[model samples]
Target: MPLTPIKSDDPVHLAMQGLFPDYNPACLEPAQDLELLRGMLRPRSSGGVKGLVHRSFQGVTRRCPRPLRELLLGLAHRLRCADPELLKEPNQCEFNRLVAGVRSQGSRQRGYAGKRAALCLSYDVDLLSCYRFLPTLLDQLDQRGLKATFHLLTDWEYRLDPALVEEVSARGHEVGLHGASHDVALGYRRDERIAGELRRALRGLGKNVHSYRAPALCMTERLMARVRDLGFRIDSSLPMSSMFHPSTQSCFPYPLEPSGVLWELPILLQDSTLFLDLGLSQEQAWSFVETHLKQVLELGGVGVINLHPSWAAKYSGFHGRLLDAAREWSDFAVMTHKEVYNCCRWGGAAPSAPAC
Candidate 1:
């Protein structure tokens, strides 16, 4: 929605050239070459060996012993991200590239007017255990004068249940669906099942929720279409994670076409890569996060961060540090997901690129 001023070595411009060399951002995915973006966003359906291997990978990540899982996570961190400092650069640039392409490619005429970049801090309350951690996280955001978006399960039987959604909403945070349950396979269910669950989840999400992020970011192309059909205006379910979903390598907000209405706000970097996978300490983890945010701002792109409530104790003061860090590097607006949706979906009291 807003393109930061670009420079000669701007990572955002370089990212577009590197990620989508022959792309036409103004036309919205017209060339078949965009298959790369589509393929990265949606994994291939299992047929034979591919299916078996996929399931095995899923099993290990889901049911492996804690020790082995951590071992695997550490190994991945070392192998792919040998230098943790650069772990998120490639992915962040992919997003910056999108911001650059949209700006330079003559897609949308309006750009973010502020000299500072945009930063969005978001949380996923994926577990009932996380319910206990919300108050502290909320307090931290409140103290920092910042706001965030929270995604919650619609069908959980927590004592608070829907009230949790209301509390977050009342606290000036944006609430969105994280599916009906925390089931990892929820995004892969049959089309009918997905639609039904979406309907049910919407019912439970009595708040003015118009966004949907699949639990664990498990998603398919058809499933995404269904999500849009169910009337979600935004989907922050994709990421360029090395350890988790091999989602898109970019992080700019773009519309899913031929119907360019529902926006896909890609998450920046896999924080889970360092924290959940690498098991890095807070100091090391925050270093990586700080660097990533700086790069995002320098490129004039929005940063959507996904921190889990379960990590509240482990990463205390992150919200405060985020605002502080953002200010040191660039001017910023720490908005919820919905605020971003409105920015990208409308322009100058009229429809712009990727607008409704």
Candidate 2:
């Protein structure tokens, strides 16, 4: 008689079931098993008093006396390490499995043969300052022969310049909706209102808008359903970090399940969280990005990097160096979000569509 194969009942396996309900357990390899173990053993966020301590310590560690600061930083780091919200690597095994599923689907649909890994550069144009640096950012990308996606905030406090939005599209870059406003609570908005606002914003962006990213990475299932209803094909609002929201599960693109219409390309690295929140120096932040990129490539996953134009302008030299490094890094294909979505959704040859 043939031996029965074991179906895991472990929490990690259960979580994976929730994330990729269609995935085959037989696809679970030794490496992925190890990754799941690591994820399980890692620290998780406890959103009560422990979370408060983590936040408070993180806030004042820099200002403490040198020796005290060292102690505080160390303690905070340990606490954060335990925060289940954080991930050692953005592309966990389960998420990678889903990516594999998409790749397989694409191959079947269109016989798609593309790079094993992809690096997507994305910008959240929420601040007015972003517009000021847009020209230079575009120029840098052009010089390097790189493509990026710029997600624009349409109904923010400062009126959006349609000309600037058009310029982004006119160039070879992709444009995506960043939300009607930079509201932190945008995700919690009533469904009808959310749909109305998003629809209006999409209309303003014209026909090229196929992607969206919620303001501040604040997204809920209801919000995603609204996004799909509004006709956006892809969303990049999910982050690998649980610090933003507890439900963020993957760093790879997966159909927003149940609805199964919209694809979510999670942010693998976010500049604001690294620089503003974690207080990493420019060099340190870039170093983290390089490490994450290398890890993503090693795992054969997509690395979606979110860099804000406002922050880039503040550290132009650093941003320039990072772009230069990305250009030099040839191990993975660098693509715009739209191109990746096309391949993921329709299974065609990697698009060589004009960036504009």
**Strongest candidate by lDDT:** 2
- TM-scores of the models, in the given order? 0.73, 0.71
Tens digits of per-residue lDDT for model 1 on 33-55? 45465555443342344335434
lDDT of 2 by residue, 116-194 (tens): 6688899988766686778888888989988899988776535777887777777788888887656545455578887
Best by TM-score: 1
Clashes of each: 3, 11
How does residue 263 of candidate 2 score in lDDT?
65
lDDT for model 2: 0.64
Q: What's model 1's lDDT at 261? A: 60
The candidate 1 region of ten consecutive residues with least summed lDDT is 347-356
Q: lDDT for each of the candidates?
A: 0.61, 0.64
Runs of candidate 1 exceeding 4 Å displacement: 1-95, 98-116, 317-320, 326-330, 348-356
Please state the error at residue 138 of candidate 1 in Å.
Answer: 1.5
